[model samples]
Target: MERDILHLTVPTFPITLARIAEPSLRERPVAVAPLTSERAVIQCASLEARAEGVCEGVSVY
Candidate 1:
């Protein structure tokens, strides 16, 4: 028997959702983080943000 599987993914889920909420952030360095905490980690980073060395798990402060 043979089985086939397909995998699909969004380029970047957090960034995609952010851009949907705020189109102006598109082309800008964007980081997905929780605003409820003063010391939250960056959950995701946009392409522009990564270019500047920003990444997931980075400190929000």
Candidate 2:
């Protein structure tokens, strides 16, 4: 018998949810990061944000 493996990703999941909750965020630059830390890292960034040079693992400062 053989088994198959699959991989899936939703890179902008956080931003998607945010936009769903707040329609005004659609088509806007959005990034998700920790709010409590002064040196927070970006966990996810929307396409608009990515185009502006924002990306995951980048500093939010």
Candidate 3:
């Protein structure tokens, strides 16, 4: 029934898949950072950045 509404073969996976599952994140430049804390790192990035030779810990600055 729920599958019929979403037209998904496995609709549940998308919800808990990962931040990488966010459609808006696909093929876009993004990263996780800290504001005040001095110890943090990027958790994930989109396919676009990977294509551009970017990845976690590649400082944008």
Candidate 4:
């Protein structure tokens, strides 16, 4: 017997949600980083940010 599977994902989920709440953030480089410090690690980055070389686990500073 064979089985089928489905996969779904929301890339840069936070940014997506933010854009939903704030229309201005749409199509912009949005990054979700720790709110504690300037050197805090990036938790997630939108496609626009990734194109600019920003990535998760990288320092926001």
Candidate 5:
């Protein structure tokens, strides 16, 4: 008996985290929130936030 493993492969399209980080976005907490003027909800949390139990789909109200 063998267990199945899920896998995915992408060709030609590559994303490297190191290249996307700017001086301000480096070595700090980062997240992608919805565009807003007032207090907006949290859409996704960064690696730092994940370490603190924050994650995607977390309500911010």
Candidate 6:
């Protein structure tokens, strides 16, 4: 017998959910980061944000 498996991913899942909940977020640069830290890092960023140089692991200053 043989088995098969698949994997999937949404790079900007957090930003996607935010845009879904807030229609206004559509068509805008969006990024997800921690709010409780002085130096926060971007966990995920939308396409627009990425185009503007925002990306995961980048510090959000």
lDDT (Cα) of model 4: 0.87
The per-model lDDT (C-alpha) reads: 0.87, 0.92, 0.51, 0.87, 0.54, 0.90
Cα RMSDs, all models:
2.5, 2.1, 9.0, 3.2, 7.5, 1.8
| Lowest lDDT 10-residue stretch of candidate 4 | 8-17
Candidate 4's residue-wise lDDT over 1-61, tens digit each? 9999999887678888889999999988889987878589988898898999998998766
TM-score to true structure, per model: 0.73, 0.79, 0.36, 0.73, 0.45, 0.79
Best model number under lDDT: 2
lDDT value for model 3: 0.51
Off by over 4 Å in 1: 1-11
Candidate 3 lDDT, 1-61, residue by residue in tens: 3554455464223323544467665445555544555666544554555577656764444
Q: What residue pairs clash in candidate 4, if any at all? A: none
Those runs of model 4 whose alpha carbons end farther than 4 Å from true positions after fitting are 1-11, 37-39
Give one digit per residue, the lDDT tens place, for model 1 in 11-51: 47978887999899889998888889879999888889899
**Colliding pairs, model 6:** none
lDDT of 5 by residue, 1-61 (tens): 9999998753211212532745565545665556673656666556665777766665565
Runs with alpha carbons beyond 4 Å of true place in candidate 2:
1-7
- Clashes (candidate 4): 0
Better candidate number, 3 or 4, judged by lDDT: 4
Error of 3 at 61 (Å): 6.0
Worst 10 residues of 1 by lDDT: 9-18
